[model samples]
Target: MVQVKVFDCEHEKDLEESMNKFLQKIDEKNILDIKYNVAAMVELDEDEQIYCFSAMILYRK
Candidate 1:
């Protein structure tokens, strides 16, 4: 059967670490693919921008 795991973090390094830890418990051969994405947005009243880091892992368990 195919399954997916999703990870999200405020920082890229955090996401990378989280993914690595999860991957360590699973069989590498079962991994089908990984998708990563980032997005940034600023509020109209704020000078700072907010960012989002996310990833998806498709695999078979």
Candidate 2:
């Protein structure tokens, strides 16, 4: 059986940082395949002062 997991994060340092952290959590070092898409988006201000983008990752282990 293949195992799948979802990881999420907000832009604090950088999106790459979030991805790295998420990758570290996965026990399987070798990923068979993976895909990612925008999971959530938020505008903190009326003028779009701040924008937040979250992503969803699908991978097989």
Candidate 3:
């Protein structure tokens, strides 16, 4: 089993969308091959008042 966490330099919403798109790419790339798994994404911050975004991805195999 393996777990992966990815962070993006984009906004939270953009990161979510981008992650979805990239996940599709990964599917097409055949990078994930397993029966047991868990994957999740979260936006830890969303404040235009700030100049940074905090996101988290949780995955398991």
Candidate 4:
């Protein structure tokens, strides 16, 4: 069956580490595709910016 796993993190390194750990437990042949994305936005009243790192894994087991 096909399934999707989603992950989100504040930093790119954190996202990469999390994805790597998950991938290690699964078969590489079962992976269909991986989608990654990043977005940045400023706080409502702050000068600092917030970053969002996210990814989606599509696979069949």
Candidate 5:
């Protein structure tokens, strides 16, 4: 059976961290594909002007 799930996060650093955690929650040991949603977003840090894009990581594992 194939399991699918969506993952999102707001972070100033690497987005991979959230992705990894999200995958684990769904017991996704092997990911098949990732489809990003249109609802994706981005935010800029006022102080540093650093940008962060919201992730809508959809995948099957």
Candidate 6:
């Protein structure tokens, strides 16, 4: 299992889209049967300029 963390997102939608894109990219790269799952998220400040994300990826060898 591999853990992925994305930081400094502008918006929630952006994060979601980025995560989806990452999933597709990983799948295309054939990274050991990767799986996408959102673990945690946080928005910083009122402008939402900063964001934190955590995801879990399970890969089968």
Quality of model 2 by C-alpha lDDT: 0.57
lDDT per residue (tens digit) for residues 1-61 in model 3: 5555455543567666766765664434334432222334555685324334444444443
Candidate 3: where are CA atoms >4 Å away? Answer: 22-50
Q: Residues 1-61, candidate 5, lDDT per residue (tens digit)? A: 5665555444524466766667676645556677653343334553443334455544444
Instruction: Give me the overall lDDT of model 6.
Output: 0.50
Q: Residue by residue across 1-61, what tens digits does model 4's lDDT show?
A: 9999999999999999999999998899999999999999999887899999999999997
For each candidate, the alpha-carbon lDDT, in order, equals 0.95, 0.57, 0.48, 0.96, 0.53, 0.50
TM-scores for every candidate against the unseen true structure: 0.93, 0.40, 0.36, 0.95, 0.37, 0.36
- After superposition, candidate 4 runs with Cα above 4 Å error: none
Q: Which residue pairs in model 5 clash with each other? A: none
Model 5, residue 40: distance off in Å is 6.8
Considering lDDT, which of the candidate structures 3 and 6 is the better prediction for this target? 6
Query: After superposition on all CA atoms, how large is the RMSD of candidate 2?
Result: 4.1
Model 4 is weakest, by summed lDDT over 10 consecutive residues, at 39-48
Per-residue CA lDDT of model 6 for 1-61, tens digit only, reads: 4545343354567767776776665654445443333444445555443344444444322
Model 4 lDDT on a 0 to 1 scale: 0.96
Q: What is the lDDT of residue 5 in candidate 2?
A: 51
Highest lDDT scorer: 4
lDDT of 1: 0.95
Better of 4 and 6 by lDDT: 4
Question: What is the TM-score (0 to 1) of candidate 5?
Answer: 0.37
Backbone collision count in every prediction? 0, 0, 0, 0, 0, 0
Which candidate order results from sorting by TM-score in descending order?
Answer: 4, 1, 2, 5, 3, 6
- For 1-61, candidate 1 gives per-residue lDDT tens digits of 9999999898999999999999998898999999999999887797888899999999999
The segments of candidate 2 whose C-alpha lies over 4 angstroms from its true place after superposition are: 12-15, 22-29, 39-45, 49-61
